[model samples]
Target: MSSDFEGYEQDFAVLTAEITNKIARVPRLPPDEKKQMVANVEKQLEEAKELLEQMDLEVREIPPQSRGMYSNRMRSYKQEMGKLETDFKRSRIAYSDEVRNELLGDDGNSSENQLIKLREERAHLLDNTERLERSSRRLEAGYQIAVETEQIGQEMLENLSHDREKIQRARERLRETDANLGKSSRVLTGMLRR
Candidate 1:
């Protein structure tokens, strides 16, 4: 495979492994450990994203044929990464809800007041989690679309560069013809004056 493909594949593999490790360990982690794990995963995810951005910039510098193939592959990789991030966040929210519920302790049939309070709290958490999920998905989709569009734009720029070269040549020819016409005009004027 091409070096670009190999680099992307390697980065994806590392990201997958890190995410898998975090998910596997999350359930078993104590509160502090869970917090630390989440932080680590977030950091690694950020690094992966930066790497992807750099790759995108490099792809723009490459020729169109290879760049298109690499861009498509990168787009696929980004979609998968987005799904993984969503899953990670969902897992964290579920875990937090479970902890909160355990702390709240459901006593035998609660008084109307207690029941209402618990219901309100649960509803709030649900709303917050839903919002988080929606935002995550939207952001991911927007980012992927931007990357793909940028690749298409770069290809268009390459085509424009070629057109620019042709225009420059045409301009030079026009200038040369104008110079010859100017000389002829000066000679005709001189003859008429004589």
Candidate 2:
């Protein structure tokens, strides 16, 4: 790897490790300190993204023969970044849940109040599930209606086509009759002349 590429790779590795450490520490810290750490990790993640972009540019400049190895390394780095981001997101969610529990005075303990809360949550979930099921049924009914409407439209189009063919045949027969009548009139006129 070129010197600049190596530098970017090293920076990415260091930043990724730092972010991972911060994510691990987030759950253990107080809410105020955790927020600051989360912000710092987010900013580092951005820097890591920029470094990856730089590495991509560098990879493009590399010769094809040696590029495969570097490309694999780049993919591995990206996967690592993805894992880090996922970890950070999970950490943030856990922190938020903790704060919400604290605000609700749950104190991570089970009690009568907790049971009531659980029942309420369960009821809410059941309501949402019923709503979703109703929506699904409506969608299915609509789909069936659309299919039937399409079939009706197809049948109408077929009938119109058949009618058009019948009209064309009628027009052809009318023209033939007109020609025969003209011939018959001419023959009678010749006889009258004679």
Candidate 3:
């Protein structure tokens, strides 16, 4: 392996070990933490896969030689790299499946299942909120009706007061006329006696 490959190999080793450790601890981790850990491991697995592919590309890029010795070494390197590639691909697939399982727990703990449940809960809450809003609107309407009724009652009382005042003035005018007629009749009687 070239010097460049050494770095990738080290990275692949570290990432693989990290992914293994994290995946092993997933079941023990709390749901909140476990979800994040699983996501991180998934990214790590992807990085590992990339490193493996890079290593394969580097092996293929080795320059050809006219001599059979270099050609033989290249063939041997290709065969070994092919086996490593297969192993890495298998591991990558397995890790990807594990990520899916972790996020979508098999037994009701799946993030996907929880998302649906939470959405339903949110919809139910919104329905209750709409009901409350409608009830408040009805309450407001009832209050407006009560206020209008009160205003009507006040107007009726004011009109009745005006009518009563007019009747009282009419009674006063009739009494004054009756007194005037009595005075005039007395004057006429005196005049007749004369």
Predicted candidate 1, C-alpha RMSD: 9.8
**What lDDT does the true structure give each of the candidates?**
0.70, 0.77, 0.58
For candidate 2, which ten residues in a row score worst on lDDT? 125-134
The sequence of per-residue lDDT tens digits that candidate 3 reaches over residues 1-194 is 46676576567657655654564455445556766866776677667667777866665666643223323333433443443344334434444544566566655556657755644564464445445544654675566557657667887999999999999999999999999989999999999999
Please, what are the lDDT tens digits per residue for candidate 2 over residues 55-88? Answer: 9999999999656656766776786777678777
**lDDT leaderboard ranking:** 2, 1, 3
Backbone clashes in each candidate structure, one number apiece?
0, 0, 1
**Model 3: how far is 67 from its true place, Å?**
99
**Whose lDDT is higher: candidate 1's or candidate 3's?**
1
Number of the top-ranking candidate, with TM-score as the measure: 2
Task: Tell me the TM-score of each prediction against the true structure.
Answer: 0.50, 0.55, 0.40
Indicate the worst ten consecutive residues by lDDT in candidate 3: 65-74
